[model samples]
Target chain A: MAVSEESQQKRRDERVREIGFVHQVLRRPEFGAAAGCVLVLLFFALFAGDSGLFSARGTVNFLEVSAQLGILAVAVCLLMIGGEFDLSLGSMIAFAGVIIAIPSTVLGWPIWTCVLLAFAAAVIVGYVNGWLVVKTGLPSFIVTLATLFVLRGITLGLTRLITGRTQIPGIKELTEGDWLAPLFAGQFGGSVLVWLADQGLIDKRPDGLPTVQGIPVSILWWLGLTAVATWILLQTRFGNWIFTVGGDANAARNVGVPVAKVKIRLFIMSACAATLFAAIQVLSVGSADTSRGLQKEFEAIIAVVIGGTLLTGGYGSAIGAMFGALIFGVVQMGIFFTGIDTDWFKAFMGAMLLAAVLFNNYVRKKASEAR
Target chain B: MAPLIELRDVSKHFGTVIALNGVSFAVRAGEVHCLLGDNGAGKSTLIKILSGVHAPTTGEIRLQDRPVQFASPRDALDHGIATVYQDLATVPLMSVARNFFAGREPVVGWGPFKRMDWPLIERVTREEMAHMGIDVRDPGQPVGTLSGGERQCLAIARAVYFGAKVLILDEPTSALGVHQAAVVLRLIVQARARGLGVIFITHNVHHAFPVADTITLLNRGRSLGTFAKDEIRRERVVEMMAGGRDLVDLEAELAALRRNGATLQ
Candidate 1:
């Protein structure tokens, strides 16, 4: 009995030590990006010191721009974590935008019908990308790079053949009639803040004054997508299969995982996401040029890598990618407010990319070594 | 009383290279049948056939005295055959519970709206691990953090949980330390107690002598012989693996060389 009691005490002591160890590891000085984000925010606040930049109106505009990029970044992050890349995403957006616009503007189809057709096309393109990659056993970089060029060329050729110009017009007619236009781009009370206020679902406050509590409809879309991605990544048997396949295909196959199927599904998901973002852009702007959405794939990839996703495969978070997009949005608008040259924006982006990669490498190394 | 699994004159060839030549073996319920072989002894080929990785060039595999053909590992699993490979087929970054429940996770809700039952998975995983005497603090912890022996044990427990009647362990102890090896051997005995037919493959004869009821030695794509542990001693088994009386000739040649060297020195 005495021996058992002593052993019990020892177990208790070990548990306490383990808790302490976990706490220390969790609280270590490795949150460099988080610190960097705070530092950037401080830099903007202290140096800019402009009332216009700090106003609620500025914040709303910032969120509006970030939402679109955030959606794209999250999708790219999922694909990157699954151990693949899609350089054709930007071209896909342009393709989808033109498809939706042409049908609604030129063919005079209902706005909803055009949107659905565009979504279906996105899904099909994504499926084809996945199928080709799996069937040929080629690297996704090569497959998607080839696809990017093919899609861009097709978009250009189709636009010139139909509209006899580089850019297609008459999209304004569709937006003027459709109710979805205001939801995407029209502002309430002619200000970004009032537009945000009109999006609220509930209005309740202690004071009689009107409470500004509405969330942007785009944010609702992001929230919905985030929930779905989280469910697919964490809560399904297929999710397990995806992680295993990405971690090591041979090992996953030996254990009876359907590796090809998972990759295909991920590809389809990415294309569909890009298409959805394109549809939003079309509805908001009410028009699109042949070169619309150029280089968005690089921006999406940068956001994903910055969010701490591994380029090789098997480790990442979709939510992190959303925050990475927000960082991009803040830097872009923040630079503009500081009266910095727009051309220097690319240099700042390059520096941010380098720093994020270095930070991710260090974090990943530390995580592997821990415990 | 019927054998849980049996291979009848199985012959497999990889292109022109013959891997297994008309080898037959039986594993009875609650028995440890050790398959011993040197390098390139066609042990891996036999394992591949049993685990449904490859079909035999000529032969019939019988489970419960009925002929069976497995199209995939999932098919083999359906027939209660589970193989724990040397690398312990699992995702290192995923949680222990996730690895255990891969390809067959429990779900709640209807189609297209279904979600994994995480709480149930955690509860069942903990219960299963406890039943196997594996003390783990969190089922959420990644399997990569576990020791090699613990990983093997987790695989064994997973097979048993999935209702495997035949557990084929391929070189499970080759990469383990002495203490870790002992732990695995104890788990083998535990599996036997649970009425599993275990095909424990190893190159070491000493490790087999403790838990194996029958030992089969293979050399050069052919079985040397199968021996009941009670009938043949460890030395005899070692001798057969060393190729009958040829070991004695080699030992005498070494002794003669030593004697000549002593005189020269």
Candidate 2:
């Protein structure tokens, strides 16, 4: 009995240690935005009183805003961890949006066909970005910057030539289609009871109006992508190679890793992700503004950096990037409740970015010192 | 037995500069062949050629008495030739197990469904490290956290586990302290005991004189001579590496400096 009790106590101690270690890692100084996100949530709950601020409807609206940004942030996190930058992502999103819309609305192609073509086009652009960067041995920043300008120019010229305007109408017919519409735009319920009510399987609601209890379908997509990215980053050999290449290309090559191939793949993935998100937005909003995705690259980069991913490369997390996006959402909604001037939001964003960067550097320095 | 690896009349040039000229060396199994040289003595150039980082402009490389041309490092690796550079060939952020099994990671399943078999990798990495007498607390810890001597030992162990018949160590002990250097020297002997042909490269005679079965001196991109362990003394090897004629000249120059100082006084 004594021996068994001692063993049980030891096992409990080990479990506690493991949990503590995980918590310490998560709260690491580099993950400033993660902590900031929690603080922001509490701040809103306390300050943004019940009615127009802290209500369930307001929370849903906040989540809806963050869902799209969260997807891009996760993609950018992967690229950053791989030790490269993509300045073309924002423009790529616009490019993809236009690709999907133009074919469906103007060319009269089926919505599914347009979606497939848009995905393919994004992958090709990514391939080109990767190939050019690898073959030329140029910095990815320069290569992606060049691509950004070229794609932007192409987007502008194509949209103007095809539609005679900078904006294009979303495929209304496809949005109304029975088979294709629900996947792109759907909602989730927070509970089983609410879910049943939302689905109209249970006629519990008095007014018969949909309760819309679950989360947005976009949030689910974002969560699923984050889970996949995390698994790839942590579990796969390719993920290991990604960290190695980003940390030091020459060193990675010396060890016989295909550095060039990894870099190229990373570029392609960033472009493909941007394009996919753009397609989702088009189906949801029913319109594509040529300028819609203009500043999204900066937003994505900010979220990635704020998430504790190194700008220089080799270390970061997708989950952290998601948290970064959540913080952005809360701030955007919270500012309105605080009666702050909407124009001041950009300045606030700039301040938050600077703070997050400083915090990340400090944490990295500490971790290295610990080593 | 025939030498496991041999380079005959190997020569390499880069535009206007000749990095190696008529460089020749051989390593038999179960022996430590030391390559001694000062800076700019074509040591690096020769290693690069043997390791398939570059092809010699004019020369023949033989493995088990058969000529072979390697297009890339992977080709060299395929032939059981591993080079452990002075930096130790490790990724700092990766776990020790990951770095140990880098390019040759074990996989499960088939096709796109294949994934790294972590349990196998971890168990094997732990066993290998333990056999090497490395007391690592966790195989999951980043290799960067280990000491310099430990890292060098891990590199040697990794090469041996990967079935390297010929291990080329480029200045393995140059960056280590006296105690750490001694640890690496012991590992070299352990490798030789395991029937590996280790080509230990270094500028320090003391480090090489103890374990080396043969010593070859390189001076100014040319081979001074190759001597069997019984035929060469440590001082002579050092003298040859310092450039015999150049050393005499340097001594004379120092004497002149002393005389001139005396006259001024």
Candidate 3:
């Protein structure tokens, strides 16, 4: 009887405490980002409802912009989660664009070959940045900061030397009718927008063109890359290595995790993502300029920080970063749709960054308190 | 049979400071070798040398009677020597299963498509923790949430499960309470029972006396001697650890003060 009673008591003590659904959601690492995203959307919906902010056209516009920032933000998220930063991302974008344009125009190389060359160059730059950071044991912030200037200088000097100007033009004419154009810069669902315009379901420009034309291919790239990154972070060995190396580099080294190799690979991946963004931007605008990607590196990092990643590293997710970029996209475009002055945009972004970081810190504290 | 690991006359020096001087130690299979010392006895330096964090400045290290040199910690791990440093064994933010298989994760798929074997990692982590007498509620929980003793147990269980021939634990029980320290000591005994050559570094004689088969004493960067449990009594061990003369004099002074029945300001 004593033994039976003890067993029953043990079972009772060992029973898992049932958690409520609200608590469950709050416990997720991305909960702050998701909540912030919803709040931002609701704010725009209520304030800018009459400015066609909810229209398909406005939605696509925000999404297109979000897609661009999202691409860079997602990669930055991966790097941040792995316990590093790449401040050279924005400059790398300009550098990659220049690489694509100058080669195709000045050298008369085929468009696709230029794409390959740009990608290779981006990866090499990223690798060198990572190698210097890990080998010298310097903080990535300082290393990438130095790289940022170096790259910007190179892009400016090279562009001026080659074209006798800051921007490279006539790329669209040179790469006209190229097969790879559609893959990078083509639009989708244009017929749907046109039909809606004919049916009086959406606004039409003075020239009879629908405000909603089609989805940019960059949106597709954003979605696809987010999915791939989420998979790599959550389901693969390299993903685990990323978390390990970022979480505690010394412990990871002791366990033989090859810390330098992981950091280097992440750097290369970040650079490749930058190249993709540059390629899309170059093809869409049909030009590459020295100042094309100015301040984009800060925007990408801001998006990641808003996504609930720790500034100190070791904890984050890609889906969270996606939602963070979504929040950013909505706010950036939503401000324009409102009657607010465009000059207030930077101030609003700074506020959002501060609020998101405070919210993330609060959520982390609440979740850890349960233990 | 040959000892599992042998450190012959190993000395480690840091510039002008000699941290470990002419120290030799060994651990046999199925035994717990407790390395005992005071604050500056160079126990850490000795363990670092053994774990390959630092190379011995002068002596040869023999694993099963063959001379070997470890260039890094990874080399030591490759030789089946796993070290679990105090408070540094696991990453606090990572999940239990992830911590269990941090460096050597199991993969199920082919190249590029190759992925972590999640089910296997979770199941094995759960089983190994249970085997170490810990009932982890969920393998997905972060290691930081575990109790300090539970974390140490997890580290010991991990080393055992990973086929380590020599388990080097650095001050595993130093920060633990009485109950937790008992739990860790029990795990050490369990490891010894499973035929692991355990090197348990601790300054507590009472904790060591319960489970150690051989005790290696160190003082001021030098080894006093290595003695089997039956070869020396507990009092002698404690006195020797406190440098004998000083400890005896201190004890006598305390006794005299107590006999006077006076409290001093």
Query: What is the per-residue lDDT of model 2 for residues B227-265, given as tens digits with 9 covering 90 to 100?
Result: 998898888887888878888999999999999999999
lDDT of 1 at A279: 76
How far out, in Å, is residue A328 in model 3? 0.7
A215-272, model 3: which lDDT tens digit per residue? 8999998899989988898889888989899988988887889999999999998999
Mind sharing the TM-score for model 3? Answer: 0.92
Categorize the docking of model 2. acceptable
Residue B76, model 1, lDDT: 93
Least accurate 10 contiguous residues by lDDT in model 1 chain A: A201-210
Kindly list the interface RMSD, in angstroms, of each predicted candidate in the order they appear: 2.4, 3.0, 2.1
Each candidate structure's TM-score, on Cα atoms with residue i matched to residue i, is 0.87, 0.91, 0.92
* Model 2 stretches astray by more than 4 angstroms: A1-33, A49-53, A188-214, A369-371, B109-113, B259-265
Is 1 or 2 the stronger prediction by TM-score? 2
DockQ for every prediction shown:
0.44, 0.42, 0.57
True contacts kept of 3: 0.58
Q: For residues A275-307, what per-residue lDDT tens digits would candidate 2 score against the true structure?
A: 868877888788877776888888989888878
Looking at every candidate separately, what fraction of the true A–B Cα contacts under 8 Å does it contain? 0.41, 0.31, 0.58
Poorly placed runs, candidate 3 (over 4 Å): A1-17, A20-22, A191-210, A366-370, B14-17, B245-265
Candidate 1, residues A1-371, lDDT tens digits: the string is 99999799679858856797765444332244445556767787898767345555456556666678877877887787777889999999899888877777678887777778878988888888999998999999999999999988998898788877766666766777676655554444324334444454223245532243343556556656766776787777777777677776776776677888888888888888888787777876767777878899899988777766767777666666766776777788888877888788889988988988887766556544425
